[model samples]
Target chain A: MRKTAEQTAEQTPGHDAPRPVRATQMVLRDTPLPPGARWRRFAVKLVALALIWGVLTEFRLDALYFGVPAILLGAALVFVMPVAPGWRISPAGAVNFALWFAVQSVRGAVDVAQRAFSPAMPLRPGFRSYAPDLPGGAPRVMFLNTITLLPGTLSAEVAGDEVIVHMLDTRADLEADLGALEARIAALFGLNVKSRGST
Target chain B: MPDLITFISAALIAAGAVFFIAGTVGLLRFPDTYCRLHALTKADGLGLALIALGIALTASSFGEVFRIALIWFFVAVASATGGHLIATHARRVDRAEGKEGS
Candidate 1:
């Protein structure tokens, strides 16, 4: 039976989630080198990461002193690391979060500096909770921390993925921004949500 | 060449700090809840990223730098996740109080 829209919104991610898995099935499945595949991928990723670090840090591979450690360390992690199969190398959420981070860091710096030496500083403070228009769990946690990072907001507490934030001023503006946030997050998640409360 | 990188990293770090300052200042100054959130989340992820990148400049080895960079990446992800969750909660609160929404 298809669940109604309202029912889905209230559902949280957990063992009882719709996509429950069977332990026995996983164990019996003829997944060849399942563990081996995971290890190989992990090792390859670390090696690639070392190369990237080399470029960013401008470290010459020929430099034995530092270069060798980088290779050895990376390889060691790949070979000996204890990562589970369900874990992902690059989750979609992380990628989207990066986008927000780059844009906000620059904005925060500029905003804070201007207020510091300015002749007049306009400020407001209040406590309020918002029913966000995004998915629960990970996205919700990000929202709370992000609130803390801005000029005058703090995430107080979260219950069932709903966020409570403190704002110095501009609640309406923040509200709109949150609306836009929902849209952006939706895009990042590839979720084709038509309206709020769609999960 | 290393010196050049150091200088750039310093500049970036300084820049990120400026954003953090502004974010806090905005938090102190903004007139309303919605606006305050706007002030913070945008700056939060980016500022943290720049600061992390700046520190990674002096990493002892490539792997160290890579690890540092990865941490920065995590902060960025955390910012967005935090933003959305809080927004959702805010909406619910507003509704309870019979308030208009954005």
Candidate 2:
């Protein structure tokens, strides 16, 4: 179904996740993307891609194989990306912390895998919500999904900025994770994140 | 043929990213809820398709690359189906809450 752009955005929530807030005045930020900021984000994306391509080049000696695609891709993105409008890039601090979240997800996933195969599985299952500190949609989505990848918690529901998560264990271990999680999300989202030990 | 493949793949990926950025912008710039939703899905579908092709082009071994390309296709289909369902439900919720006009 070739729906129009207007048709796609106005549609419903994508998953079983909580419905997005209706477009209220509160959700709209006055600080729209400035021209300079847009340029900077484009620059960052370009540099990152170039660096990745450099790595690819080191691995593959066939310049004729990769150069054409990389150059064309670079040129297309250079012109196309800066103008599209949505590229909301977090600052360096936030980006750094977001990477940390990815690492945390891997750790949580490993712990989960270990427990899943263990003889005496230390499992606890429950649901809880926490206030979100991050602003934009991507970070919040990334945050929730990454947390779900963690061993014990799957983000079952998100209401406004409050995410209701399901976890196997809600004890001291979970408590410790929440604190670190809170700090990490707070660092990334800039929202006032709070937790009463997962409840 | 290789040149054509690379050129087309890169073009698609770049275009996809552009759409994604556009969607993100639309989500912010659009006046109401439904309008923003439209922005998101359009970007999501096209952008993903483009990126998957681009990645497929970068792979060394044909078999491994082809496998990953299949994964990308599956992921695209899954997310697209999901976005459609969500959009429908969202519209219903909006209408019920008198948010349809907005």
Candidate 3:
């Protein structure tokens, strides 16, 4: 199965094609950003950093003496940083994803706590490799990070499009859960990803 | 109203503390690295989040509340990234040593 994945990756070098890299050799290759897009990203990052500064300093005018330079430096660093392919966030989808994430975090914590307190310690831990449908970028990274917060799953390794997930219970329907999570992330990014079990 | 808010905050904070205890216990009791990572990430993530929310409720101003939330956000991201890094390292070491899943 791993060999087949590598062969396919070698054959395809498209934007959505997964790179044939080992888990340890996972490096984010930067995609060239247009001048207009670069400036837009800088503007967005500057505003975000300024808002963070305002919250941290309680909107104090005197704090701007330090905050102004820090914000500019932080925003300026974006230009030198590798610019990966970006995704557009949908406001409605973000609200939905946030609500779902909150519920899942509580459920995941409660599930672990119950097993920890139980005398039997009913844990059937193992690893499962999943082929994610979301393209390799912010959407895929979000899916991996979010998996750790979901009940009974932690993403361990990523090889190409395959993510190895450590699960507390192997018997759980992980495929469905991963598919749903991927769908939620795709929605959040306004990307139309194919649902699982579909061609 | 302030008194009621205080009572609720205290309750939420106490509940958060319970999860922290459970997380610690799981860390000590779980069989191996991966399982323990699950316990650490999930329990502590929720624990800190609950504590942050509780504290935010009592914050003096909106800025204070946002600051508390920002702390929670940063911690959550850090913990998740840290957990994944540790898990990856352990997996690599296990493979190099010719051991199967932990």
Best by lDDT: 3
Supply every candidate's count of residue pairs whose N, Cα or C atoms clash at under 3 angstroms. 57, 19, 0
Worst lDDT 10-window in candidate 3 chain A: A15-24
The lDDT ranking, best first, is 3, 1, 2
In model 1, what is the error at residue B97, expressed in angstroms? Answer: 22
Tens digits of per-residue lDDT for model 3 on A32-56? 5566887888899999999999878
Report lDDT (Cα) of residue B37, candidate 2: 38
DockQ winner between 1 and 3, please give it: 3
What's each prediction's TM-score?
Answer: 0.48, 0.44, 0.89
Candidate 1 lDDT over B1-102, as tens digits, reads 999999989998997787777667766765555555655665545567777878888678877777787777776666556665565556556654668643
Kindly indicate the candidate among 1 and 2 with the higher lDDT: 1
Instruction: Compare the candidates by DockQ and give the number of the best one.
Output: 3
lDDT of 3 by residue, B1-102 (tens): 999999999989999999999999999999999999999999989999889988988999988888788889989988888888888777776765668943
List CA RMSD, all candidates.
11.2, 14.3, 6.7
Q: Give model 2 RMSD, 1 decimal.
A: 14.3
Question: Candidate 2 docking: what grade?
Answer: incorrect
Which stretch of 10 consecutive residues in model 1 chain A shows the poorest summed lDDT?
Answer: A15-24
What TM-score, to 2 decimals, does candidate 3 have? Answer: 0.89
**CA lDDT of each prediction against the hidden true structure:** 0.58, 0.54, 0.86
The segments of candidate 3 whose C-alpha lies over 4 angstroms from its true place after superposition are A1-31
- Candidate 2's DockQ is 0.03
DockQ of each: 0.20, 0.03, 0.48
For residue B53, model 2's alpha carbon misses the true position, in angstroms, by: 27
In order of TM-score, best first, we have: 3, 1, 2
Candidate 2, B1-102: lDDT as tens digits? 988888888887886676567556655654444334334444444456567768788767766565666676566445534444454455456555675242
